[model samples]
Target: MRLRRRVSPLKLAVLGGVLFMLVLVVLQRDVSGGIQEPWFEDLSNRKERMLELVRGAVNNLAFQIPGQPGTPQLPAGGEVDKNCPSGFYTQAELKPWLERPPEEPHSQGAGGSAFQKDNLTPDEKKEKEEGMTRHCFNQFASDRISLHRSLGEDTRPPECVERKFRRCPPLPTTSVIIVFHNEAWSTLLRTVYSVLHTAPAILLREIILVDDASTAGGCGVYQERR
Candidate 1:
């Protein structure tokens, strides 16, 4: 039996060139500053070595196989998807940022009309004023009555009057989970900042984020910011 010859130099060179181009396509999608510089340099050097190795292997394989051809070279200037890894987002994936929820308007005094104040009739204005006054008084009365009730009536006051009310212990902490399909970087960051600023540090435990299969590159920006 005759032993088959290895791949030829021509085939090996072609395979090597193809691998180099693949590396370039991969690098073009990188946007982060820190990763781009070092990644490009490393990829360039590694690609050179990879091309040589692939070329040699292809040549050897070509010789061994009677009719096997080397790997085909990809066309130049072709586009490649450089979106974030499997769990990450791509630019196109997060093209449109999520619309913000409408803001809650500032509350007016109870006596103020919901609509324009000028639209109210004299009778309506009088009713609103009376209603506001009653509401204020009720609140004030409740607080005062509670304070008085807490201090029981005693003919002779003890050195330390017995306090009747028992204060409740603190409640358990809670976690808020926000699920987004394809949220924008700005909106996501704003949400995080709002939570951090407003939520009581002791009461808030952790914020769990669940992604619902959003295909976007903005996820990378979110991660880097975090």
Candidate 2:
């Protein structure tokens, strides 16, 4: 009887431990009562914000430009062009750049004006025609002034412009490849100049100009001068 009494306490202790473990497991599962995740709400909000940004980017990409000849000439920055199919910035976003000056030209030097055939000598007419072919590589444009203007005139916010540049000796070289298929004279040169003006000179390995076959060809303007 004494032996049975001592074993009974041991059995009770084991049973109690088993019950405590079972209760603990049941409470672990039911503690949250199958509630939704706390972070799920935040995840949903972030997803909505990302979607909005993507939509804005797509709209901006669909920027316009006048294309058809006799397209009611909207002076540079005059109105949103309907012809340009896509762009990095939207019309509304570009409005600040387009608004005209106070009826007084800031600085007028014959810049990127399309060479007019009306009052040109035969040689001049030929040069102008060839220039047009290179302008868009046979692409169409109803307006040219806004884009052909100098890069200095760009109105973009200077987010990427470095306030301080890091210079290192023995800088690694880089090769820049610019492919042209009847590209415009001013813009092409600008594209090249843009690189030269921005990048560290020591790092520029080689500028490789590969020209795709373009039918546009003409007498070299400098060759005539020479």
- Model 2: which residue pairs collide? 65-84, 77-98
TM-score of each: 0.25, 0.32
lDDT of 1 at 101: 31
Which segments of candidate 1 are over 4 A away from where they belong? 1-167, 222-226
lDDT of 1 by residue, 1-226 (tens): 9999999999999999898677576674452334658757677667668879999987655532323575232335764334311222233332322322333233221122132235767876676565447443322222112111111234456633331211112224678788876555444554665565445565578888888898765546323210
lDDT of 1: 0.47
All candidates' lDDT scores? 0.47, 0.47
**Candidate 2, number of clashes:** 2
Candidate number with greatest TM-score: 2
